[model samples]
Target: MTGGAVRPEGPRASERAARPDGALMIEARSISYAYKETVALRDVSFGLPKGETLAVVGPSGCGKTTLLSLIAGLMPSTAGQLRVDGAPVQPRRPGTALILQDYGLLPWKTVRENVALGLRIRGMKPDAADQALREVGIADLAGRWPHQLSGGQKQRVAIARSLALGPDLLLMDEPFSALDALTREEMQDLLLSIWRRHRTSLVLVTHSITEAVYLGQQIMVLSPRPGQVVGLFRNPTVGDRRAAAFHEMVNRVRDALEKGVNGGA
Candidate 1:
C-alpha cells in the first residue's frame, strides 16, 4: 500500500499531532454490559486518543458491536464508566456517528434523500449533502434509489450520510463485511483517506485480522462472550498492509484472539 507516491498526512493530522499525547477523546473504565440475563461485556476498558483509530477484533459474539454501541451512546453500559471528551456518553451525543454492516439505508429513499436525512437534523444546506456524496465518490448516483445500487454503492451512501453530519467520532460495526473482497479493500482505503483528511476519531469492530492491522492505530483483541480485553497492540505504521510489520502485527493479534477465546487472557 505504501508503494504509491508518498502523500502528506494532511493538515488536520499534523495539527492534531501537536496536542498532548495524553489527551484522550474517549476513555472506558471497567465497562460492563448485559441484556436481561446475558452479559455481553465485562471489565472492558481502553483509552482512544484524539484523532487516532482503534480496531476491536475477536471471534463472533465477543461484544465488539456492543462496545461500539456504548461509545455511540445507543445503549448504556450496565457497569463502569464510558466518557467522551471527559463527559458521560449520552444518546444523540454531539459529533458522533455509527455505521452498521447492513448499510442501514431506506429502500424507499433516493441516494440523495438518504444522505440528506441525517443532515436535516442540523438544518444543513443541501450543498452539504451534495458535498458528502462527492466525498465518497458517489455524487453521480445521487438520484438513484438504494435498491438501484450495488452493495458497495449502498455502503457508500451510508458513509455519506454519516459524513454529512461532520462527526468527530465515527463508530463502525463490520461496515465492510458484506462486500466482495475487492470492494471491501476499496472501501477500506477510502475510509482511511477520509479519516486522514478529517482526523476523526474512529473505532471499528471487525473479525478480519488483516483488516484490523491495516487500519487500526491501536488494535484491541477481546475474549469470548462476556468479552474482556485480552490485549492491545499498537500499529503506528499500519497504513500499508503490504508492509512486513503489518503482517507480523496481524499474526500477533490472531494469537491474542486465540488465547483470549481459550481463556488465556
Candidate 2:
C-alpha cells in the first residue's frame, strides 16, 4: 500500500456499485472478429453485471485481448452486438477507460500532466485529476516524469489517469505484466481497493490464474486460437483473497485452461 489507505467511501456508493437487482452493464452475444482472414475470436458471448469484475484468462493468442478490445470499442467485431450501460459500444466512448501493459503514458508529460491528460482532452478541469494524484498516493511525485518513477509508480500513474475520467467500465489488458513480483502483488491489492471504492465494472485480461482468481468476481476462460468461452466460474473469494477458496479457484481455472488448451475446445 504505497498509496495512503484506500478510502472506503469514494464519491457515492451507488455510482461505485451498480444496483443489486443484477442489472446488466455489458452484454455481448455471438461476437466474432478477424484480422482480414486470420480469425481472432469466434462466437464469444458473455454478460457482465454492473459494478462487478469479469476476468478473462486463456492460452496465448486466445483472443483475450481481442475480446477486451471489442468491449472497449477499440475495434469493431465482425459479427454480434455489444452494449455497455444499455447503449451500443462506440469507439473511444467517454464512459469507458482502457489501460494497457505498456503504461501508455506520454514520456514528455509529468505525472500530474499524465493523470490530467484525459480530463484535459475531455475539456474538463484539472481539479479531479489533482484529487486522483492524491488518491494514488503520488501527490508529491506529480512533478516527476515516467522515466524517473518505478514500475509500480508508473502503473499507479496509469491507474490514476484512468480514474480521472470517472469511467463506468474500466478495461485492463495485462497492465501489471511488466512489474516485479512484489510490486505486482501490491498493485493487485491497490487495484482491488480502488475497485471496491468505486464499484465500477472492471474487465481484466491476464495470463495468471492467481491474478484472475484473486481479483475476479467472475472468471471467463476462453479456448486457444479462434477463442470461445470454454468455462466461466463464479469466484467465492471476492473480499478475502487469503482464503482457501481463492487458491482452490485458481487451481480450477488452471485446470480449465489446461483442458481448453490440450483438448482444443
Candidate 1 C-alpha lDDT tens digits along 92-141 = 98699999999999889899999999877677776678999999999999
* Model 1 worst lDDT window (10 residues): 1-10
Q: What is the lDDT of candidate 1?
A: 0.84
| TM-score: model 2 vs. ground truth | 0.91
TM-score of each: 0.92, 0.91
Superposed model 2: Cα runs more than 4 Å off: 1-19
What is the Cα-based lDDT of residue 254 in candidate 1? 86
What are the lDDT scores of the predictions, listed in order?
0.84, 0.84
